[model samples]
Target: MKTILVTGSTGQLGNELLQLSHLEKDYRFEFVDRSQLNLASEESVRDFFTNKTSSDYLSIINAAAYTAVDLAEKDKHSAELVNVDGPRNLAQYAKSIGAKLIHVSTDFVFDGNHSRPYNETDLKNPISVYGKTKSDGEDSVLEVNPDSIILRTSWVYSQFGKNFFNTIARLSKEKESLRVVADQIGSPTWAGDLARVCFSAAISDQSGIFHFSNEGVASWYDFAYEIVRAFGYHCEVIPIATEEYPTDAKRPAYSVLNKQKFRKTFEVQNVHWKERLYRLVEEVKGQKLT
Candidate 1:
């Protein structure tokens, strides 16, 4: 069986990918946490491939990244280590061994200046530390391994992590009103859908940048309202401007990605954000009832 190495096995995306192991019977998934393979340290990454697994990796899915957007401003070094250096190391290693590498990136690569949806051909103009690091990461990966696939997504949320969905659900119980930024707009991507795309890209011959997100655009306030309504939370969702919520990092005002490239290349179904939110809320509620 072909062996697939998945980094960040415990993260939102990686965990979602783990659920698909049973379906792809032809490929054996080898999961690893940070302890087994630290991307920041070249020695660790080098040692992992040298001694850890005997079989050559058929595909490598990199889901690990320093994702705290606000925290990234204060922690540039850490962010660069994982975001830029990590992918660079992986790309170099993947190239040496001829392994198919799929690296997960964010829409932050673009400065959110575009009035239209961002596609793979869009020029990257990162406005924040996190965004800059991610942009650098993408360049490094492609510089070493042109065959490597870069999957740029935006506003990702899942049941596993501390995301917008969980935060709204929790705060709604405590606060009667929830204020979310109304100015910034982007598509909310379900990590499960992203995980499926990662697997698809890994198995395909197509390589280059691809944007994947749930089909539809929404602001943070719009997303919060939908979450509260879906979760049956009684809190009133309040729309506030970006100035009201000051952060350490500057967020893009718009980051909706055009999925025509991904759809054209992979030919996968892209679900709407509202529909995904409903299903996820229902899934969580059902799990709670049991």
Candidate 2:
């Protein structure tokens, strides 16, 4: 069986990929968290590929990243190290060993000024440190390995991590009223859906940038409302503009990504955001009942 190395094994997307790995028996997986393979350290990355595994890997899925948007502003060095330098090292190593590298990126790479959904060909003008670093990481991977595939996604959430869904669920149980930003618009992508896409990209021969997200658009308020309502909570969710909520990082007011390229290239059916959200909410509720 072909071996595939998955970095950031404990993260939301990484965990989802691990859960689905059993379905694909053709490929053997080596899931490594930061302790096993530190992407932020160049020496660690080199030593890992050299001595850690006995056989060569067919592909390396780089799911690790410094995803703290607000913390990235004060901790620019750490963010750049993981988001930019780490991917560069991975790409270089993948090139030397003749392994395909699938790097995950964010929709924050765009400035969100466009009136319509962003396509792969759209110009990137990142407004935040996290966005700039991720954008730079994408360039680094492609520069080091022309065959590398960069998958950009938006508003990623999952049951495993600290995400909007769980946050709202917790808040709904704790508070009677909640306020969410309504001006910023984007699609909430379930990490499971994205993990499947990443796996498909890893096996495919296609090499380029692609955008993937759950179908449809929604504001943060809409998302929060759905989460609360799904859980049968009585919390009043109030919609507020982006200006009302101040943060260290400047978020894109509109970062919805177009899925035409990804759908056409991968021939994968995209799930509607609401349908996936409902399924996930129901699953979480079921787990709690048990």
Candidate 3:
């Protein structure tokens, strides 16, 4: 069995990937969270690979990142450390051992500029510190190993981790009405869908940048409305403009990605946003722990 290393084992997507261990019997997996390996420290990163190489691990799936989008504005250094420097270290190590690197990135790199969905070829113009650092991370990975696969996704949510879906699901119970930004529109990708996509891409002939997200576009308000309905709640989802719900970062009005490259290259298809959301709700309901 081929052994693969998965970073950020505790994250939303990483946790989802762990559940697939039974489903993916061909690959033997070793999971690592920040406590297991620190990407920011080159010595720690170097040491992690040094040990992994001793075991002859051949691939790395970098799912760890400092994903606090709003907080990144104030915590730029920490974001850059984890998002940029960490990946650079991993890329360098991956290149050294001829290991394939699958790096997860965000759609925030494109400042919501285009009318249509963004393709892999679209120019990146990140407006927020979080996006800037993530884009930098992508460049570093590609620079070190051209064979690396970088998956750019958007509005990632899951039943496992801290995300928009569960946050709205929780908050709806406390508040009679919730206000969400309506101007911004993009795909609400399930972490499970993305995790499977990552596994497929890493094992396949595909190597390069790919956009993975659930099919169909929606605003935060639209997503919130769906979540409230899924919870069987009667809370009103108020659609507010971006200006009304202002943040430090300037979010793109539309950041939908055109996933033609991923679909064609990896032969992987994404489910619609609504179906993915429904299934996630079901999963959450099953656990009964959330």
Candidate 4:
């Protein structure tokens, strides 16, 4: 069986990946959360690789990242330490051991200036600190090992973590009205779907950048409205422009990623975002919110 080491095992997508590990007849997956392996430190990351005992077709699926967009603006160095240097160290280790490096990235890498969906060949001009760091990480991974695959995802949410969908569900139940940005548009991705795609890419693909997200596009308002409607809830979703509700970091007005290259290469069918959203709602309906 193939042995895969997953970093950031406590994240939304990382938790979803662990769920898939129950039926582990085909592969053996070893998970390491931040407490176990601090990717931000070279010594810590090096220690992880040095202690690995399994050599059965090794693959490192790095899902760890510094994803606080607003905070990243203030903590630029900390962001680079985890997002850029962490992946660089992992890539270097992967190269040394001839292991496949599958690194997760964000859609923020694009400047969101294009009218149409972005393809894999699109030029990146990230405007925010978070995007810049992730873009730097992508460069580091590719520069170190040509055999590395960088999967850039957008607007990811899940039932297991602090995501837009869960927040909308919680706020909708508690409040009469909710305001979401209507100007920003992108594909709403489910972390579970991305997890499956990552697993496939780790086992099958050669090296290159690919875009993966649930099919279709919608703004934040559209997504929130859909969530409440799907769950048979009565909540007023108000559409507000980005300027009306500002954040420390600028978001892409349009970051829709085209998954044609991924579909063609991996032969994996990416489902529509709404379909997965329904499944998430069903899964978390009974869970208590703090």
Best candidate (score: lDDT): 2
Q: What is the C-alpha RMSD of each candidate to the true structure, in Å?
A: 1.9, 1.8, 1.4, 1.4
Task: Pick out the ten consecutive residues of candidate 1 with the lowest summed lDDT.
Answer: 281-290
**Global local distance difference test of model 3:** 0.88
Tens-place lDDT per residue, model 4, 1-290, is 77888999988889888987785568899899888888888898788778454374478899899999999999999999999999999898888878899999989999999999999889999999999999999999999988999999999888777778888988998888998999999999998889988889888756899999999999999999999987778889999999999899999999999888888889676778888888777877778743
Candidate 2: the clashing residue pairs are none
Estimate TM-scores for all models: 0.96, 0.97, 0.96, 0.96
Candidate 4 clashes between residue pairs 3 or more apart in a chain or in different chains: none
lDDT of 1 by residue, 117-141 (tens): 9878988999999999999999999
- Score candidate 4 by lDDT: 0.89
When summed lDDT is taken over every stretch of 10 residues in candidate 2, the lowest stretch is 48-57
**How does candidate 4 fare on TM-score?**
0.96
Number of backbone-clashing residue pairs for each candidate, in the order shown:
0, 0, 0, 0
Candidates 1 and 3 compared: the better one by lDDT is: 1
Task: Report the C-alpha displacement of residue 76, candidate 3, in angstroms.
Answer: 0.9
Tens-digit lDDT track of model 2 for 1-290: 88888999999999999988988999998899999888888999899778433256888899999999999999999999999999999998888888899999999999999979999999999999999999999999999999999999999998887888878888888899998999999999999999899989988999999999999999999999998888899999999988898999999999999888887889677788989999988888855321
